[model samples]
Every structure is written in C-alpha cells, then in structure tokens.
Target: MLAWYTAVVYAVAGAGVLADAGWWPTAALVAASSGLVLKAVWFDPWLTVGVLLDVGVITAVACSWPASVY
Candidate 1:
C-alpha cells in the first residue's frame, strides 16, 4: 500500500526533474518519502531497496559539485 505510494511519488518527482520543475518540489516529495521510509521500516519488504533508491536520488540532487562540469 505505502510502497505503491512511494513509487507514485518517485515517479512524480522524476517527472518533475525531467520537466525542470525545480528542486523544491522534488525535495518536498523526497522529504515526504523520508517519513514513509521511516514508517515502513518495520514490516515493509521494500523498505531497504526503496530507501537505498531514495538515498541515491536525494544524494544526487542535494550534492552541489558542478552543474555543467560534472
């Protein structure tokens, strides 16, 4: 149930990223997912995998190394 929502949110955020909708919206989605991740830490089988995926996405977006040089 929640895992499905997480997937949907990720899809939305991914689309926002592709559409150049700014990072704030994506960040908000990711932040919302953070709580879902924590909430699902108990019985959700997708928690580990989903969290890892979210961590990767958030890390990539939050990191500020270079815009056109990376």
Candidate 2:
C-alpha cells in the first residue's frame, strides 16, 4: 500500500537522520519531495503542514550545503 510505503520511507529517513549517516540527506529529500505528490492525492489540510515542513527541511539542507556545490 502507498500509505505503508510512505510510512516506511519516513521511518528510514528519520532513522538515517538520527544516525547521522551520509546518505540521510538523500533519503530525507526523497521523502519530502514525494510528500508533495502524495499530499495532493490524499489531500488534507494537515498534509499542507507536512508539505510546509518538508519545504523547511529542504531549505535547511540547502543552506547547510557548501556554496561550492552550487
């Protein structure tokens, strides 16, 4: 199920973050980016909050990256 997959993705991303793994950013980005489409199909006002949070996470990640990567 899509919801189950979503849950797993979120869990993996969270775990990766907590563990400070080098790959966490990629996993987080995947979860956040996919949340955009998933939120659309399963529209909920609360989901909008999630999308906003995802945007914030993306911004934070981008800001943390070195300008050299740009």
Candidate 3:
C-alpha cells in the first residue's frame, strides 16, 4: 500500500520535472524521492513519514505554481 503511493508520488514528480518544472524544484523533488526510496529499500522506520512529506511538498509546489507546469 505505502509503496504504491510512493511510486505514484515519484511518477508525478518525474513527470513534472520532465515537463516544465524549474531547476531548483526539480532538483528538490529528485533528491527527496531518492531519499524516500532509499529509506523504503532499507526498511527504515522513517520511510512512511518521508514519503508522506514528499507527497505533500510536491503537491504544494504544484498547487503554488499551476502556471509553472506549462
């Protein structure tokens, strides 16, 4: 369940970056997604929080700049 949600979040971020997300925002999303994946792969307890935070941040950034997405 959690893994599926995380994967979806990554897809959104990747699509955003691939489309028209700015450099800094793209970098942030990449770094965040990478960290979350690392946590999940390692069975870290923080994985849940990390993924949730990443999703929230990504959603917020997207909502904040609807025009930035092209």
> RMSD of candidate 3 to the true fold?
7.8
Worst lDDT run of 10 residues, candidate 2, spans 61-70
Give, for candidate 3, the lowest lDDT window spanning 10 residues. 22-31
Tell me, by TM-score, which candidate is best: 2
Better of 2 and 3 by TM-score: 2
lDDT of 2 by residue, 1-70 (tens): 6666666787897787677677767776777777766887889887778889878867767686534333
Error of 2 at 35 (Å): 0.9
Quote model 1's TM-score.
Answer: 0.54
Candidates 2 and 3 compared by lDDT, better number: 2
Could you give candidate 1's per-residue lDDT for residues 11-56 as a string of tens digits?
6766765676655455544655664565567646656675676565
> Could you tally the backbone clashes for each prediction?
0, 0, 0
- In candidate 2, list every pair of residues with a backbone clash: none
Flag regions of model 1 displaced more than 4 Å. Answer: 23-32, 35-50, 65-70
Q: Give the C-alpha miss distance for residue 45 in model 1, angstroms.
A: 8.9
